[model samples]
Target: MMKAKQRIIILLLAGLLVLTAASCSSQKAADPATETLKLGVLSLEDILPMVVANEKGYFAEEGLTVELIPFQSTVESQSAIQSGDIDGMMNDMVVAALLKESGTDLKVTSVTLEATDERRRFAIVVSPDSDIKTVADLKGRELGISFNSIIEYTTDEMLVAAGVSPEEVNKTAIPKIPVRLEMLINNNIEAANLPDPLITFAEFNGCKTIIDDRGRSIS
Candidate 1:
């Protein structure tokens, strides 16, 4: 019940974000009366607001029907969007830009999550058995991240802040979040950047966080 309430509050904030972004990008939001929107999303915790809102009839109150579609990976979700299977997506800025670059008509609708001074959504963690103890130790090391995505972007930003040059930053692309988490837990990957719940789960499983998006503007 507490979690549900928390998600409801987040839903309010997300509602504001969507309205503000929609107004900036266009004249106004689509008429909610008798409108239906099919939205695609990965199975990430950030979907809580959407879930809560839908369950609570927030959209219905606005006369909109939102259908949430689940995709296992970002690539799958992007493909679905390209093929017109879904009208919109809950994705990071990096992916939104990628979609625009690939000629898909896209817009920054809203931010599901962002790093704040008190909290961050992403982190770089090392296996319990791995020798990489510090951020500096990650230079030229195998760091798993989804290439050209927000995962890699966050990793790079944090690495450079720790004095690791772009050339020295070695990153391995493991796009699937579950795969990255599994590999890191199994010691198949020395380190990987993961979002909140997964990052906390990995830490519970003995992974050590060396750096995160905390205090940084990037998310």
Candidate 2:
């Protein structure tokens, strides 16, 4: 009798297992196929992880189809996402905030990178031969930057941190980074905010860094 009862219990448990499997199968059948996310990014070292994940098939393994769209500049990438040319982008938080303020319906899902001593991402640089050695010296000087963007925001913060008011510094709108770097090199601009690779390149070409947002959380 006890053996018969045990068998009955085992059968009931198996029935429950079958029901759960059927429910899951029906749910999966009702759901749509995995989605493909079109994400935009600039050609920067900070985006290396995304590149690696795509190369390694990690996104595929997770049931996500990712398409990485590369743009020459952050503004271009942001515009792509805003215009629905792409679904999302890797950009500065300040830019994202400005986008939201300007009525772009978007959300910041994650922070991919942070400022650190080992990974200096942004800096204010000047010609090595220039007399502007400190942030305070940047006062009343023309700093080349893409106005109303993250570069300007960071420059303002860095300058204020060094006891110089943003209003005291003259900002020149130079949207193209290469142009800004060239202007800095040729003394066409007293100073300019630059991101990695460019900052390193400028340094190699006799540019002096005034301040860097290292060990600080910009986003």
Candidate 3:
């Protein structure tokens, strides 16, 4: 059996050990890794939840300091990521797939949105005065489209479904939807392909939707 003083010394040593353990835990809690994390967002609408997360301090509660950077295009946002100017981005799957195919350092960490209707985000149209009433009527008529994306695939599908071969239409490449819209408005092209909200805008300006992929599958 130990003497009473020895017993007290053992108790004190045990207390010291407990205090040391508590100190270590406190240091860990205060470490820089516990600090807020930086993140990037493509646009306000691209991921509204991210905007809400930042505005409502949800990320702050999670120890994150997400910096939302709005870019004109997904390509611009992806470029920012590649250059390390931003940590990550909420962008289109095509951009992500391209990056992965090329073995880019960036990986799509999460998918915020999956495209369902091709026309949910895009639409095919003709001018009100134009005789082109159906997709079949698009033969020899100008059709505008962006290159090498879901747009191309969906447009090709639209053409095929309308009994029009892809070769039948005068395919024009106007990469920007706004430019395509301008062409449509100016009658430079009998038909123009554009994405939303340009689709909505074009329709508002009297462009007719001859074919829509709203309920159609692009996959």
Best by TM-score: 1
TM-score of every candidate = 0.82, 0.73, 0.64
| lDDT at 73, model 3 | 48
Candidate 1's error at 150, in angstroms? 1.1
Error of 1 at 77 (Å): 1.5
Tens digit of per-residue lDDT, candidate 1, span 1-219:
657666686665673222112222364566666556878876677887787788987767667898988775677777777877777777777877777787777666556767789887899999989999888998788888887777878888888888887568678878888899999999999999998889989999999999889889887
lDDT per residue, candidate 3, 1-219, as tens digits?
Answer: 235444433432332111011122334454334543335443223355555556766556556565666665445655666665665565555666676677655544444332365426556888666778888888888888765655677788878887789988888887554567778877778887666566777788888888766766653
Residue 115 CA displacement from its true place in model 1, Å: 1.0
For model 2, the superposed segments whose C-alpha errors exceed 4 Å read 1-36, 117-119, 216-219
For candidate 1, the TM-score is 0.82
User: How do the candidates rank by TM-score, highest first?
Assistant: 1, 2, 3
Runs in model 1 deviating more than 4 A are 1-36
Candidate 1 CA-lDDT value: 0.78
